[model samples]
Target: MRAPLKLYLAGPDVFLPNAAAQAEAKCRLCAEFGMTGIAPFNPDLDMARPAAQLWQEIYADDLRMMRESDAILANLTPFRGASADAGTLVELGWFLGQGKPVFGYSNSAVSFAARSRAQPDDALPGTAIEDFGLADNLMIEGSLTLPLTLPPDGQCRPFDSLEIFQLCLEGIAGWGQGFNR
Candidate 1:
């Protein structure tokens, strides 16, 4: 029998108040879909180390996990400012660079240009706003192996919402089936 696909779950969900719980929930959903979800925070680092050392260890460990995964499922919901989590984007790029399949979902219904523009016609100061009607940056959306389609109603939940997360998992599972063939 084939082993279940390992998916590196990348997102800003690690910053959520109940990150561990969220990870568990996502893992459970992955299991339901015949895949294993590896949340970025699943590793238990030694807290006794110095703060800087611990952070470095955590980053290294997460990268190791990403390298081992079969593919990546990233939550591209706008974070901090008007873009996806910078760290998550980096991970996604790393996985893409490795030639692995990439999938993403964004909770925001707004387009990237709409979110970045200060006003309807105003650009992001000096930078040009891409009017591609995509969720985030074109490089991100263009790299996705599966399209992120919103529900018919067009309403989306928060980053921690299991509903949206499940959608991402389903996409990964479907992609995996085709990928293995």
Candidate 2:
């Protein structure tokens, strides 16, 4: 039997209060879809260490996980800002750089342009937002050829919702023997 594909889970969910729970749930879904999910957290890492040293270790550790995975499943859901989490983008880019398969899902079906409302403290006021009809940035969707995965009702789901996440895994499973998993 073919081995299961190892998928690197990327997103800002690592910063969430329920991070471990979220990762466990995702891992369970991955197993059902015939793949292995590797979340970003490392329980062995000492959190009480110096801030700078700990952060560096985290960066190295996550990269190590990505190196071991066969593909990446990124949560493109927007966090505090308008676009997807910056850290997730970095992980996606890392997978893309290695020519590995990259898949993504977002809870928000709204275009990034629509979400890019100008605020008084905006860094670049009057800057035209790109409206290419994409869930996030052009570079992201342009490379992945991924359409926004939304619920059957075509409505936005919550950040932690796994409805679309399963859809993404199904899409990956639909790839069949291509993954050799």
Candidate 3:
């Protein structure tokens, strides 16, 4: 039998207050679908290290996880701004560079253009909003032919909402099955 697919879970959820709990929930969902979710947190890291070293260690560990993962399931939900988390976007690019299957979901149902327009005038002056009806920048959305997994009701949800997360998981699970065939 084929081994379970290892999926790198990329998102800003790690910044949430209940980050560990969120990761555990996500991992459980992944197992239910025959995949392993590798959340960004590494419990083995030495927390006593200096700030600089901690950052470096986290970066190195994340890169290693990405390399070891079979694919990436990214949360494209906008966070702290009008776009998805910058770190998650970079991770997505890295996965794409590695030629791994890329899947994404957005907690927000709003189109990228709408979200851009909602940004403060000074935030995106003279920026042309691309109207592809995608949840994020065209470069990110254009990489995949498949539409991003969204909430069934077509409404926005909290970033930590398991409902939407499960939708994304289901989408990735389906994609993985077809890919393996």
Residues 106-127 of candidate 1 have per-residue lDDT tens digits of: 8777777878784444543576
Error of 2 at 25 (Å): 0.4
**19-117 per-residue lDDT for model 2 (tens digits):** 999999999999998899999977779999999999999999998999999988999998887788998988899898889888888988777888886
RMSD values, in order shown: 2.5, 1.6, 1.6
- The true-versus-predicted C-alpha distance at residue 5 of model 1, in Å, is 0.9
Error of 1 at 154 (Å): 1.8
Can you give the lDDT of residue 42 in candidate 1? Answer: 42
- Model 2 lDDT, full chain set: 0.85
**Which pairs of residues collide in candidate 3?**
none
Worst window of 10 by summed lDDT in candidate 1:
118-127
TM-scores for candidates 1 onward, in order: 0.90, 0.94, 0.93
Q: After superposition, how far is residue 167 of candidate 3 from its true place, in Å?
A: 1.4
lDDT of each: 0.83, 0.85, 0.86
lDDT per residue as tens, model 3, 37-103: 9999877899899998999999999999998898888888999887999999999999888888888
The candidate maximizing lDDT is 3
